[model samples]
Target: MPAPHLLLVEDEPRMAAFLLAGLEEEGYRVRWVDRGLPALEAVGREPFDAVLLDVRLPDLDGVEVCRRLRLHHPALPILMLTALDAVEDRVRGLRSGADDYLPKPFAFEELLARVEALLRRARTAPALSELTDEPLRLDLTARTCTVGGRPLDLTPREFDLLAYFLARPGQVLSRDEIHRDVWGHDFDRGTNLIDVYVGYVRRKLQEAGCPDRLQTVRGLGYRYVPVSASLHDDTA
Candidate 1:
């Protein structure tokens, strides 16, 4: 397959250079845009497998950019980068239609993993056709998801996280395993990255009326089982 094309929109020159170098090293073809307007124009002109958007921009805010992009192309996956880590900031990011949110000062390794996982999950079939205990339905080709006949407006990270569970339904996966598979092998397991993103997914699922599907296994890890399935099926 051709290398995945990534649209990186960051106002900070240093940050943009840093991310471009890292993504290029990972073999991704990247197109850099310094402001929101150019980013919007670029997205409208070409096809990108995924987008890395910064929240604070000179011309437009990241949330508005995400909203505009989603309006033009609903299926395009967007991951927002910002220094804002507060609950309300995160909420705003998702509400604006960003698929995932990454606070500033993130690890390059984690960034690569996130991009890869999003692309990986983007390659699955639609979730509606399958009614199994697995609550995920990925049509990677078309980049769409439908959980229990209801569509999930998943950011790239949520989609990748859901796809990871579907790939190993009913199996217990440690946080380390999830990070290795979803984030990348070089990611630091010490950070609360997994937990934070999982929380994001839960909130979105709840919005979709399928919050119960993604279960917290406490000390073990997390798993996804269809909410419509038997309550006794705790294996997921």
Candidate 2:
């Protein structure tokens, strides 16, 4: 499949370079515009899956550009980025019809996740009631997990961590990805809470006789490996 294309509007050269490199590494096709007017022009000329708009711009303001863009393309996903942490700034961006907001100094993983989420919502689908990989069944609504019909008693955090891995079976989940999505915040260098939780979940899977094991990738993160081809994933 072709990668999703993105438009980035930021006046700072260093910040733009940082985002472009990181996003491109993740397989996105990105076009960089240093000003807001060019951003509007670019969107009018080409289709993009999403836009990462910075609050302050060289010519036109990002919020005004967002408002105008929304009028022109109502369905397009716009993710506003700003160093301003004020609630008013966020509210103004939302009022301008941005699809989401991310304050500056964000983890690249978090930014990537938000972009993915925007695309996901744009192409909305039926919600999954369960995430299953063979003998391991994670009930989405009931919030229960079972291995071979025997339930494994788990803490709320443990359950969420397992569910996360189950959703993306066989995918290499970065430490930051797990920390941000499962724990609902940025990955803190000062803490090893994610490691601690992952350990707990991994041990439970082992004890429950689950064929899929959460294997740490040493310096990277974890990948859940299905022991057999028949052990497949399904959102039922």
Report per-prediction Cα RMSD to one decimal.
Answer: 12.6, 15.3
Residue lDDT tens for model 2, 137-168: 88865778899899988997688788778766
Q: In candidate 1, where is summed lDDT lowest over 10 consecutive residues?
A: 125-134
Q: Using lDDT as the measure, which candidate wins?
A: 2
Per-candidate count of clashing residue pairs (backbone under 3 Å):
10, 0
Instruction: Give the per-residue lDDT of model 1 (tens digit) for 1-236.
Output: 88999999999999999999988888999999999989989987889989999999988778778866764455678899999899999998997678788898899888887887777776773323222343545665445677676677888767767666764566777898777556643468779999998898878767766545667788999876654454665554
Give the Cα error of residue 235 in candidate 2, in Å.
52
Q: Which regions in candidate 2 have their CA more than 4 angstroms from the true location? A: 125-236
What does candidate 1 score on TM? 0.54
lDDT of 1: 0.77
